[model samples]
Target chain A: MKYYGGCDAGSTYTKCAIVDETGKLVASVTSRSRINPVLSAQAALDEAVATLDDLKGAKDLAYLIGTGYGRNKVPFADENISEISCHAMGVHVVDPSVKSILDIGGQDVKGIAIDADGTVLNFAMNDKCSAGTGRFFEAMAHAFEMPLDEFSKLSLKAKNVIPITAQCTVFAESEVISLVGEGKPMDEIAAGIQLSVAKRCFVMAKKAAATDSIALTGGCAKNHGLKQAIERVLKIKVVDLPVDPQLMGALGAAEYARQKGLASAKA
Target chain B: MKDLKHLYYLENLLQDANNNLVREAQAGGRLAVGSVCSLIPEVLLSLPGCFPVRLRAPNTGSIDLGTYYMTSMSCECCRALLERAVEGGYKFLDCIIAPDACAQMNRCVENIDLLKLCDKEKFFISYSDVPMKSDETALRHYVKQMRIRVLEQLSGVYGVDVSDAALRAAVLGHNEACRLITAIGEYRKEDNPRITGYEFAVLCTATYCCPKDLLVDKLRETLDELGSRQPDSGKNFRARVVVAGSEIDNPDLIRLIEGSGALVVADRFCFGSLPGRQEIVLNDGEDVLLQICRQYLAWGKCARFMDTAKIEERQSYIDELAKSYHADGIIFEQQKFCDYWGYERALGSRVMRDDYGYPVLSVDLPYAVGTNAQLRTRVQAFVESIEIKNIQGKVTR
Candidate 1:
């Protein structure tokens, strides 16, 4: 019953996933990534481990790999692989045939073209722009004084979606407020916001030539409206992975740890 | 992986900016004249007792003050350099010779002048009107302008000899620096390069910090030290890459790119090997100043050109280097909000991918490095993509 740990200290959240040698998810945890990412990752891992019946702490793990933005910050990790590679690995494990990935994370959106074996063929990420990010949606939700889950659900209900085209999140938040003030329907504005994000993501998708068998990952993927908008624009079916999309990076890190541990064990 | 001796010496020279090389040269009774663009021929500055330093704001934290004069919409590189000028980073310079190379730079010079940022008695600026086009008429005007604007002015002001004999020595010394740098670049072409991209950047930047004669001597010594060493296989990379875009003085971004398992073997940009470190070929009886002006005009990599042929010619420079260096991909490193490169990168990426048949990773970032994690992810993905393609190609074959 060998096991490995994967830590993902991202911009907004720190997540850790522990898996058995057979690639079974043993336990997982997520929490806000504070100023100190190292502590956040450690705490997340500890909380996850505490839930396990047999395991007491990190010492029980065969290998602990790290991924995401603060991948190198996790002192306990054996190696730091980029979040891009992690995402590919996690998605490929779920559906090997999936060739394209659109991961709109907390800060930015990454459009990736990959092979069946989880190797990236091409990729593009937005620069200093939060038009198609979780933060953008969060800000919009904050403006509406509604829970993010409800706002996402409301977008799908819009029949006559009003077009709002502010690229910056700050500007778009204000635009959303102004639209609400002008008696524009909330569902319509939400739909427009989803459309805007979908459009922003497509530019990067085009760069990577991500046209088919798309896998939508990241925390933002949980939004049904945004997913449908991306599918409508791309004209491709977006598949949902077996594991929670938010855990993709951590899962990939665990997979890498498993592979590397096996190789080292053999040597 | 860390015991590269030559890199340590170069890193020391790169890290400490306070009177390490420039002021050391000034203490030797040599005038240190700083310039903005590589277009300012070294012969003009390196006469008898003068050192030419290209202004670079290394480890620049913020341009909050610089944006006050030039709006935040201006190019990050210009704003960074302008901020350093305002922050007294360039106060040690005798005269900052800014060229009217592009609009952003012109704005930077304008702001510096309007603000009267530096010590009036010790510091001054020579805004040379560089020729935009590569025509014969423009060439003549450029040569004349460079002579009057930089040559005659420096000679008159600094009280140095600008004779043909002095110019010839400057040419040879400049050529010597280029020769050594090109030799260093040639090492990168190796299957396992002894020099890393960061190390190469440090070596390239050393020319801008120290006198050519001093740099050439130091480079020669470093080459000798490097000659006895074997290439390290521990740092085996996934694919070889070429860095192409606007001027790259800082190696932090290059270090990040290299960290992603891509070995940067070639560079085609301002302040890079394509033109800057290319050996200067002095013709038989041709004027030294004219030859330099022609070289700078022909080899200009900035995106400010209106002429399509000139842009195509520069594009070929990248293609040829990529082909020659056997590059797997190109990283289009542009500073954020560079109006010229914004257009250039869009057009260039399309042409490079479609016509030239080379993959390009376009990155627009703040001038500083290690701040952006998204950038690292992109570079990593890019390398993985290139590697995956190679594997896919092999399987298909």
Candidate 2:
């Protein structure tokens, strides 16, 4: 009857995951950009507790782990781990064969290369620019006056895609508007946008030597067009797990907490 | 981790050497060269058996030396330079040499040192009369004072028997190293680049503390081996980029950038073009160390040292370097926690756009190896933007 809880507070969104002793995903929740991370973490904790109706009144959680950008800010967590390590561990838990994991979040993108045991060998990240991240796509969606879900769908329909050149968010927005004015089809423009993200991701993947089975996690992975575009350019099929990709970081943190808890008990 | 520990030890040794050199120079009553462009005078000090250390702060510390200056001391680099001097890091020196190369360095001497606000117990202030016109008479006078002061200092510390032959050889050795580094830089400009700008900088800085013979031989071998390696195919680069920022010490970042098919042709970092070029010439039997020291103090354009109209001048220099190198883009790398270049970010970006009509990418780097994917994406997209499609005679869309 042991219980484990995890939290992942990212720049754009915060996520939480709960798993039982048998590794069953009991409950998971995610909140958008507005809430403060401390509050967001509480919301996620509440959601996890609510999912376990029979164990709702159970106050005895075996272990809790906090991770991601705001892991240190999580007050209730028993321990904390870096998102870089947690993401690798979480992805490996889902598919142990995944050697390379590319996590594209709202503000940053990371490429992690891991060993069979889920230990990070070498990793690279991109936080300085927003061109290749979820934020870039969000900005593009805003310019097109489309919801993110619809935008991804429309992108798949483009007969001819026109590439946007500027890496800057402001400049790229203008380029999209100019393309719209030139009577370019919407789907093609969307495809071009996906292409841009893919190009940046490809550069990172090549640097990390994205070898063997690769996992695509993070908020951007939900985009069908982006996933397809990345797969095509990399010339490799990317594995997506059934568990919510956004929650993987938190799950890994929880798993780490569980292991530490068990080791201390043994000691 | 072992390499990092080794670097830590090396840094400590440099700091110790700097302190001892400054103390010996001051005790012997020699003038210190403290200008960004005072390479000649710095060399002269070394040749004359007097110590010449660049006034810089330890990479970490909380002492606010710039607090003694006025509110107008907004240039963080200039403020940091003054702070280093005030922190008693330069307490061992006999004289503080100030070159009038830049406005900030000039002001630091006139306002900070000349005002007698700094700790004056250890050092005197000597200003070089190197006019913008490069006056020979002024150079001779400065060289004479340098020699007399250094000789007096050597007599007190290690005795006056310091051989002129040994000093000349040291000066020639350093100058030759600079020549070899410059040659390496020239090699980087080829279509199929052999070495990177950051690697070239490492080779240059390693020479500062490393044995002269070892460095010279190692560099010669590296250059020969580099020359034999096949060049990167010039076909893939969507755009050529010039990288500028604080000294890029991370080899991983450089490899990531290069692997993205963008050749870095020029840079404004400490480890790049700065150390390679030889701008100062030493006169025979004219105290080679002093000549080099004075030139080192007078050299401007480093972000660390501020000069009159330096912002505009640096922009122009970057523009010219980009044009000469045929760079298609420019990446402005600003290290996190470095307050000096953060202020220059906006202006630097404008300079790249307005002056050169090139796309400028601003990268804020952390100490850790992060930002690889994001940088790759930004660079690739930039190249893809300018990608040209060749249309053969058929059209059907």
lDDT of 1 by residue, B29-111 (tens): 88888777876776578778987887778878878887887889988888988898888777677887877877898898778
TM-score of 2: 0.51
Docking class of 1: medium
- Cα RMSD over interface residues, candidate 2: 13.2
- Expressed as tens digits, the lDDT of each residue in A63-162 for candidate 1 is 8888888888886788778788888888887778788888888888887777667876667777577777999889989999999899888888799888
Q: How much DockQ does model 2 earn?
A: 0.04
Tell me the tens digit of each residue's lDDT in model 2 across A1-267: 777777887878888877777776777788874557787777767767787755562244677877776776675788666677788778878888888888898888888777566756446677767887888888889989999988877777667778878888778989999998998888898899898888888867764568554788888888889987888778877887878888788788777766766777689
Model 1 sits at an interface RMSD, in angstroms, of 2.0
